[model samples]
Target chain A: MRNILAIIERELRAYFTSPIAYVVLTIFVFLSGLFFRSILAQVLQMGLMSQLQAQQLGPRAMDMPGMITRGFLSTMSVILLFVMPMLTMGLFSEEKKRGTIELLLTAPLTDLQVVLGKFFAGVTFFIILLLTTWIPTGMLYLYSTPASGPILTAYLGLLLYGLALTAIGLFISTLTENQIIAAVLSFGTIMVLWLVDVLANNAESSTSKAVLTYLSILSHLDDFMKGVLSTSHIIFYMSLMLVALFLTYRSIDSLRWRG
Target chain B: MITVENLTKRYATKTAIESVSFQVEKGEILGFLGPNGAGKTTTMRIVVGFMPASDGTVRVDGFDVFENPLDVRRRIGYLPENPPLYPEMTVAGYLRFVAKIKGVPKEKIGAEVKRVMERVSITDVQERIIAKLSKGYKQRVGLAQALIGDPPVMILDEPTIGLDPKQIHEVRELIKGLAGNHTVVLSTHILPEVEQTCNRVVIIDRGKIVAIDTPQNLRFQLQGAERVFMEIQGPVPEITSKLKAMPGVIDVHTVGSNDGRHRFQIEGELKKDIRSDLARTVVQSGWGLYELQSASMSLEDIFLKLTTAEERE
Candidate 1:
């Protein structure tokens, strides 16, 4: 446990001391802010038009807070797909390129300790990124009344989703020593997982469609967006994270032999 | 103490090392001498538990490297060919990190880093970023990292490869100072480094150890013939024939002739001191002996002869 903390401290310092952290934070916050404004504008205009229609016909129900929060949270999830690779590209790849992996491996620590330490570093940065979304969401609280339940659940969903993505990126980082290759390959892999949902919708057979939907990385995320806390969805995300981490552990073990 | 037997590493494309074995007694410095691509780095890496050997057993302090890796690693301080340094970190921060990972006591981390920094003479540059430091400084930082926990065994691969002559001298001196307390296995292709620093040398060629002995013993074993030179004023053919006739003198030839002085190159039996005999004979034969000098084989000659002679076979 102490070894893991030591590695995490080193990894976090490595992230924050370089330009990569600042650049990534700035880009993510700026883009999320832009998408938030656009989504808020669209939500307000639709709500006003619906209110006018209700006056002409009969009273109708439209949950403005839920609609806007869900829209904004969904956009944040998509934005994460683009930003996660940058955060994890250097986790193991940089270590290998600089030959610091030898130092870590030859130290009095196990491979799992090194892998977990790096994984948590990426997750910590992602959490910091997730906190930036609260700024726009916090603005919603001051101007209008929004349900706290859905907002909390939405944040929970984003956290789990981001954890899964980070684990995937960490595994890919172990595959190569070049950060550029690691980043591009992680992006490609996540893209395929994201597209699997679309593939599931077009499948003609029920069994094939069911398996494809279950395998899609985003399929488990929809329930959390709807403010539904289901054990099945939580298990999906947790299992995905564990599987990726396990693969990373095995990869490091093989690297020791292959070296 | 470290003992390695039949350590072999075979990559998919080719074998890096084959049947290489050696032992280092406690408080002895063993120099691994080999040219480039001769598996010097591979052997050290396996011994330090950086990688496992394909077909051998390595016991460091009685713990098998493959079986009890953490036990072996905790006792070893390894410096790879390139210093494992993070470019963004300051020298002080990097040393602190190494000390932490190497498992120095929490209270002693600060003192340990300071001791190693002072030992390597890098206290002045402790705050400088590793990337910006000069190559010599970076190499010293690498050495400092290895000395962090003061492990009983240190495995350094080509530690003085890129330094200037003065820095090389300092590093060699520092390594020599580490003897009698820390067991060291340092690899180098430079001949004099082994002769100057190591207690024993294991000469490797083409992924195999060709010779293993002390520097002086290796020279004597590989160089079968002894040579001597003398300048004399006499008939050149007479001197050559007379020198050749002496007991244990293998060959004699007149190399050059100057103003009434002839220089003769003479070869004699191994382990024989023929210089005094030649000098006495020259003065007795009514010849003016201007100079008499013995030319023994240097380590360079033995290295080349051992490496190339195997290639021809």
Candidate 2:
């Protein structure tokens, strides 16, 4: 455990000392802000008050705080697909390129510790970047009453999405010494999963389409975004996280024997 | 203490090392000498547990390398040919990270890093980024990282490969100062470095051990008999015949003639001092002995003969 934390501390310090973390955070915040403003404009132009009045909804009909938070969550999730690869590209690839992987491999720490430490470090940084988006989301409370449940659920969904993608990125990073290749592969893999739902919708059988949709990370994330805490969605995200991490560990293990 | 027996490593169809074996006692400095691509690095990597041997048993301090890798790793410190370093990390930061992974206690990590930095004379550059440091300083930092955790054994692969003459001397001195405490296995293509630093030498060639002995012993074993090189102003035939008839002389051959002066290489039996005898015989024969010096086989000759002979076979 101590060794794991030591690796994590080194990784965290590396991320904080480099400019990549700040650049990622700035981009994430800017995109979140842009999406928030566009969502607010569409909500206001829809004049939701009349729709709620005709449906005998309360005076809180104009309160589209849930929709605003959902918009931020969806945009952040998409943004994460880009930012995660950038964050994890150097985790193992740069270490291999710089020959520092030998230093780590020869150390007393197990391969699992190195993989977990790096994975958690990337997750921590992603969470920190995600938190920066919440500041703008929190401002919604000042203008109108907002339900905290949906906001909290959306945050949970974003966190899971980030964790799953970061794991995939780390796995890709372990596959090569070239950071550019790692980044591109990681982004490409995440994009395929992100769009799997669109392809699944055209399946001939409903059951097959449902199975494919369930396998898509974005499909599971939709549950959390809508304030539905489904056990299956939680299991889906956790299973993907587990499989990605396991594959990463195996890749690093093979490197030790083959490198 | 380290022992390697019948180690073999094959990469695809190319064999890196084959049936190579050697042992190092406590506090012994073994120099691994070979030309480039002679499997010195491959053998060192196997001993250091960086790469597994295709077929062999390596025991470090009585722990089998493959069976108890963590134990072997804990007791061994390795510095590869290239100093593995993160370019963006500061010297201090990098050392501390190495210490952490090397299993140094948190409280002692700072002191350990400081001590290694001072030992390698990189204390002043601790705050500087590794990428910006000069090659010599980077090598020192590399050495410093290996020295962390104060392991009992150190495997340095061409520790001074890229240093200037002055830096090489400095690193040699530093390594010399580590004698009697650290069991060092240093591999290099530089023959003199083996003579200067190692108490024993292991000559490897084409993935095999050609010879393993002390520097002096290797030279002495390869030298057949005490010979002398002499230049004389005499007829080549007369000098050769006269030198051959001497009591102590075994054979004399005219090696070369420069400006009417004949240079003859004379070989004789061991324990024979033929320099004075040859000079007298040349003088008495009415030939001026311009130069008469004993020819000693250097370590370079022994290394070349061993490695090149293996190539022929």
Best by DockQ: 1
**Candidate 1: what is its chain A TM-score?**
0.97
TM-score of chain B of each: 0.90, 0.93
Going through the candidates in the order shown, the clash numbers are 0, 0
TM-score, every prediction: 0.93, 0.92
Model 2 chain B: ten consecutive residues of lowest lDDT: B218-227
- In TM-score terms, candidate 1 sits at 0.93
Task: Tell me the tens digit of each residue's lDDT in model 2 across B1-313.
Answer: 9999999998877998999989999998999999999999888888878778889999999999888988999998889888999888999999998998898999999999999999999999999999999999999999999999999999999999999999999999988888799999999999899999999999998899999999988888777567899999978887888789989778889888999898889988776777888888888889988998887778998888888885576
Measured with C-alpha atoms, the lDDT of residue A255 in candidate 2 is 82
Per-residue C-alpha lDDT of model 1 across residues A129-204, encoded as one tens digit per residue: 9999989899888888988888888888889889999999999999999999999999999999989899999999
Query: Which pairs, if any, clash in model 1?
Result: none
Predicted complex 1: DockQ: 0.75
- Give the per-residue lDDT of model 1 (tens digit) for B207-249: 8999999998998876567888899999988888888999989
Model 1, position B300, has a per-residue lDDT of 92
Point out where model 1 deviates above 4 Å.
B230-266, B274-292
